[model samples]
Target: MAYDLEEQEKLEALKAWWERYGTLATAVVVVVALAVAGWSGWRAYQGYRANQAMGYFEALEDAARGVNGPGGADAATRIKAASDTLRSEYAGTAYASRGVLVAAQALEEKKDYAGAQRELEWLVARKDQSTLQPVARLRLAGLLLDQKQYDQALAQLNNPPAAFAALFADRRGDILAAQGKRDDARAAWQSALAAMPANAALKQIIQLKLDALSGA
Candidate 1:
């Protein structure tokens, strides 16, 4: 009789403890399960987005290369359409920037300077978190320079990243030289030469420019 009574008391205590903590324990389990499911769903969605972006990018490449036909007006139209889609829908993806750059190059090759400028300007305007921003700006500046839009080109070359400092200076020299600012051009080229790596192939070219400037 004593052992039976003691076992009953222990059982009652266990029941009381569970009644107090069971709800909290269940809630924790539910929260953990939801978090895991949410994470998995997010990963799947990202993969889907990436795949879609890749498809659009491939189409843009094909159009740019004239893979579908002789690559005339039809190809240009296709390239524009595909690039527009990528920029509008997948601007967050690396492929979007790449598509825009490719489209710009193709348009420039076709002597569609206005179209190329528009595409490059769009990319530069976004100022998104893309590493390609620098490239876009540089290309835009080059296009402006070719058009003899000196002030606009200089504006785009301002405050370039350190990695591109030498290139920017070199281009600036070209612009200044075109404007007949000989001393300024020489200084800019000297800066470019100083920033270049010792074994850089461009170093020799930059040195030649400097020497030519001195002779002039």
Candidate 2:
């Protein structure tokens, strides 16, 4: 009987404690649940936006294909329109960056370097995944190189991540070669060769650069 009484007393104590703090505990649990729900909802919204962007891009491609005008400037305009839609409707998605790349390439093909640079600038401003950012930076650097903006191009290529470092170095060498800095270009090419994989095709290309630079 005594043992039974001790167990009953402990149960009563537990009940009282729960009664005193139960409301606060319930409120905390509810808040946590709501927080999780909100995060999930935001992710869902982002995913939906990405899907919408893909649809818009497909439409834009179709528009480009059917576009008509002298010099394909009409196609450039269509691509720009699609890019604008992506910026307005899905700016937070990876598709937005992709749209920027496509529009920039189209503009570049039309000899609209300035317009292409502007799109690249917008992409640089966005928060993108590591892989995408490096690719964008590389392409932007190439555009700068085409404009003979040597300093800007070199700056962009100087600090790429490991995945892009070799290509960046090779581009830097190309820029140096264009600027008449043969020795510096050779050194850069050597660095590129060291960084690049030892595939036969790549090795042959690097050897050619070395031979050309050395011969010159």
Candidate 3:
């Protein structure tokens, strides 16, 4: 009887514990299940989006290639449509950024500087697009320079990424030269030449600029 009483008391304690905590335990299980389902759904949606964005990108490329062709206007329209889709529906993807670059190049090649500048500025404003920011910065600076917006161009070229250091220096030199800051231009050119790969064709071009400044 004593042994039976001990077992009964243990069973009662377990029952009380379950009565107090069963509802909370079930709620935790439900929450975990929903979280897992949500994660899976999110992943699937992202994959679908990436695939759709790629399709738009491919179309953009073909259209971009034709933007300088005989039917340039028609091609430009197609590129605009595809790029618009990427920008609006798939803005978070690499394809979206690449599409913007392609569209900008096409617009610039047609001498549409305002349109190109707008596209490049759009790319630059996307803080999430770290991979494409430097490219957009360089292109935007070039556009500004062509427009004689010297101050704006110089500001964009400031503290360029390491990969673009030489090109940035070269652009700065151009801007400084245009402003008639010969000494500063020469310094910038020298910096560009120093940063350039040895025996690169661009180095020769930079050297000529430096030589010109020497005579000035």
Cα TM-score per model: 0.89, 0.78, 0.84
- Which ranges in model 2 have alpha carbons more than 4 Å from their true place? 1-18, 36-40, 63-71
Full-model lDDT, candidate 3: 0.90
Q: For candidate 1, give the lDDT of residue 70.
A: 68
Q: Specify the poorest-scoring 10-residue window by lDDT in model 3.
A: 1-10
The positional error of residue 95 in candidate 3, measured at the CA in angstroms, is: 1.5
For model 1, residues 1-216, the per-residue Cα lDDT tens digits are 355888999989988988999899899999999999999999999999999999989998888887335657888888889888988999898888999899999888877889899889988887774578888988999999899999999999899889999999999998898888999999999999899998899988888887888898
Model 2: per-residue lDDT, tens digit, 60-96? Answer: 6665564444637667777888888888878877777
Ranking by TM-score: 1, 3, 2
Which model scores highest in TM-score?
1
Q: Between which residue pairs do clashes occur in model 2?
A: none
Instruction: For candidate 2, report its TM-score.
Output: 0.78
Worst 10-residue lDDT window for candidate 2 reads 62-71
Question: Residue 170: error of model 3 in Å?
Answer: 1.8
Candidate 2: residue 123 lDDT (0-100): 78
